[model samples]
Target chain A: MKIGIMSFAHLHAEAYIQNLRAIPDVELLGIADDDAARGEHFAQAFNARYFDSYAALLSAKPDAVLVCCENSKHRALVEMAADARVNVLCEKPLATTLTDARAIIEACERARVKLMTAFPMRFSTPLVEVKARLDANEFGRVYAFNATNQGEAPLQQRAWFVNKDLAGGGAVMDHTVHLADVLRWYLQSEVVEVYAQTNRILYAKEIQDTRVETGGLLMLTFANGVFATIDCSWSKPPYYPTWGGLTFEMIGERGVVLVDAFKQNLTLYRHDLKRAAWNSWASDANQAMVEDFVAAIRDDRPPRVTGYDGLRALEITLAAYESAERGEPVRL
Target chain B: MRVGIVGAGSMGVVHAASWQQTPATLAGFFAESSHDATRLAEKYNARVYKNYAALLNDVDVVDICAPTHLHHDFVLQAAAARKHIICEKPLARTMAQGRAMLDACRNANVKLLVAHVVRFFPQYALAKQNVANGSIGTPAVVRLARESARPKRPPNNWFFDFEKSGGMLLDLMIHDFDYARWLAGEVETVFAQSIATENPDAPLDFGLAILKHKNGALSHITGAWAFPPPNFRTAIEIAGDAGLIEWKSADTAPLEFFLHERAGDFPDVGLPSSPLREDPYTTQLQEFYDALLNDTPTRVTAEDGLAALQIALAAIESARLGKPISLAEARA
Candidate 1:
């Protein structure tokens, strides 16, 4: 399988590139980014070719491409990859808008190429075990879910993250989609309505330009009567543990299940770093996601996480924004 | 100070024990069932009043630990008797009731202290102090979770009645709601989702409320009554520009701090590790007693209790209406 990365915008791209290189049967074709400096830097660092233009990378005829462009730029790159008939594993929040997401999916369908949305939480080992238990009906009827996906502000790593136009929105856009996709998959239910509250409080003094929200809480009601609360916020401090964490409590009739996706970590208090940091020694969810995407193309099968799945999650995330704006729930 | 307690249930027992530790005399207590009142009074070496009014007449301060639905009447009676008041959380079930209670206390010119014991918890109190001291910079976001087993109530207990207890949002989550409002400012809007497995044979309840603070802060408040007995856990995370403050009951370590400064000892600042010999309940009662003796204002005022109640009620309404409720609309 030949896999090329579209852009080096999202920080996840760095880890993903490593995962791609580690796969035995996979050939990492090259990297492409409109930002020539970033593209060239990563390419040189990884010992891979750098394509100045996305089209030039597609000309190499890679079997699949990982879309790591800005949130707002996902649609264009996915459409381009689809036009070239290359399967794509797009980063979370498929696109900034439902229209763009639909266009991306439609383009892929028209070109007869597979489109998978990156949702690595579904591949996290602990969450995988939880999903397995849920599948076995060990929890009976799930009553509610309290989940959180939190991270530090990405301003230091990706300045575009706080830029609404480039990143789509702040914490809500960046974090909500991951858990939204996971909940939908785990419960096998569609969200019927969404209500959200958001704020730009975290970086009010430091951030003067962006209109994005740094903290947000989304309430979702699923069709199956299960309700969930997702706390998606860029509220972690820079010197804290690892970048972020994902955790949840699932309440059911028979029993309750608590899961911390990033709990397999060792905490080290570093005097030089001047902070206690969580070093995660858990299985690489990103590696599993990359392998799944590659195996789907190699096996001539649909990726476990599809473009439509992305669409549904994106719809919830977009509705959350709308709900926050209107100060009311938005029904799907 | 002579103290009288209403409702000889678990909370009443807790209040009685705490009051015993204070300089106040446990004059008497009243309950719907004389059996419970007598049992609790005997344990505390106090007398059991025949009725609420009798207890009110005998005491200088009225401590209402009654069911939530009875709070309004108790407050009105205590205020009419011109006694200082200390009431357990969720001041009243409805907004009108809460407002009337607040007005009555104000009109009677007596100190009205609501038992929002969470504010007295060392972990939470330290977090608030740190925020006030600008240790974490200006607070931007807060995530709070309180999980406990279903309350062990006798048959026909008011807690099981939605109208009486206001379900988990009022009965269980009101603590987080009050603490959130205390940490952040006034709530501008609330969006909530809840689930209740109300079957007598299989009881479970969960609630999540998102409060968008008027000051641009955001809070995610979660409460659960689905865990099995002897299991109660709470976790809180506050994030701001300079750093983050986190505390979890499941963690063996003290409250964790992660500041952005990178050239000092790990954690930068440390919280006291020694546990307080006094319980939060006792601390709260002692504070109330001191305020009464000094003729100073109580830490948590009637107005603050009213504000917390308003948020809780709005969250409940939002969950029922399947929408977010604006504080302005709630006031109107």
Candidate 2:
């Protein structure tokens, strides 16, 4: 399978590149970014060719392209890919607005091409096992979910993340969609209502231009009667071990299942580094996600995480933003 | 000082044990159930009063650890008897009741101390002290989580009744609400989401509340009553311009600090080497007794309790209305 990357705006693009390279049968064609310097820098560092424009990369005839542009730029890139009749595996959130999200899905559907959202958590080993247990009725009917997806401010890696226009919103847009997709997948339910609150508290002093919210908490009620809370915040401090973490507790009729996606880590206190760090030895979820995407293309089938799945998750996230803005719960 | 405890359940027993470590004498206790009152009195080597009024006549201090719905009546009767009062949190189920309780205490010239015990926990106390000292610069954000097993009470337990206990938001999460207000000042607005199992056969509740503080800080508060027994955990994070401070009950390490580069010269932050042997409940009771004896101010005043209750009630209202409630609007 031949794959190209569309933009390097998101830091995850670096990890996805490694994931693509590790697959024995996969070919990494090259990378493209509007910013010439950033595109060339990574292209050279990874020993790959650089395309100055997204269109130039699409012209290379890759089987699929990974969209890693800023959230607000996703719709344009995905539409461009749809026009080229290329398969796509866009990053999480799909797009900033529901209109843009729907447009991306519609374009892909019209072209009869596969469009997948990059939800690596679906491939996380522990979470996968938990889901299997739920499917097997190991915990009985799930009653509720308490989840958290937290990370450090993205300003350290990409300043555009804190910019409202570039990133859509803040932590709500960045983190909520991941868990939203996971819960929907796990319970096979659709969120019917959303209530959210957000604030520009975590990075108020660190960044000035962004009017986005850095902290957010969302409450979602599903059609199946299960309710969940998602604490999506950029509250992690810079010097902490890793950038952030994901954890959840799922309550059910028979028992409760707890999962920490990044728990398989060794805490290191190194004098040379002058700071503590968490060295993760966990199975690479990104690698699994990339493999799944490649297999879906090879089999001429839709990816396990499809664009509609992305649309659904994006809907919940966007509703959360609307709820925050209107100060009320939004019905799906 | 003679302390008469109202209610002979878990909180009453806890208060009884803590008072034993103080200078106050355990005069007696009143309970709706004679069996519970007798059992508790036997264990504490105290008397069992047949009625609340009789208990009030026998002691100088009335410690109201009864069901939340009864707090208003207990407080009013105690105030009428001119006794110093120590009430368990939520002060009352409604703001009107809380106001009346506060007013009655004030008019009688008796100290009213509400048990917001998180303020007395050594770990929490140290964090508050550091914040007050401006160790982390100007506080900007706060997050708190308290999780515990669903209370397995008899069918007749009032806690299972939302109307009487105010559900999980007012009963359990009010601790974090009080702590957040104590750290970040008054809340300007609140939005929340919550779920209580409608099926009486499966009893559990979870709540998440977001408070936008008047000081430009924001607080994310989460409480869960879905875990199994012997599985209580609490975690807190406070972020400011200069750095962050974090603590978790499940982690072996003490409170951790990650100061910004500009704060490199600040003193090393460390938790107390030896954990304080005193129970926080005992410490809080001691503080309350000392204030009364020394004619000093109580650590958690009636006004503080009232304010925290107001926020909790507002959060409940927000959850009910499916909208955020401004504190100003709620007050009006």
TM-score of each model, in listed order = 0.92, 0.90
Off by over 4 Å in 1: B52-54, B253-275
Q: Least accurate stretch of 10 residues (summed lDDT) in model 1 chain B?
A: B265-274
Cα lDDT tens digits, model 1, A244-303, are 889888889875788889989898888898877888899999999999999888888998
Docking quality (DockQ) for each candidate? 0.58, 0.35
Q: lDDT for each of the candidates?
A: 0.87, 0.86
| Residue-level lDDT for B325 in candidate 2 | 86
The digit string of per-residue lDDT tens for model 2 on B37-138 reads: 899889888999988889988999999999999999999999999999999987999999999999999999988899998899888999999999989876
* DockQ, Cα level, model 2: 0.35
Quote the positional error of residue B306 for candidate 1 in Å: 1.9
How high is the lDDT of residue A177 in model 1? 95
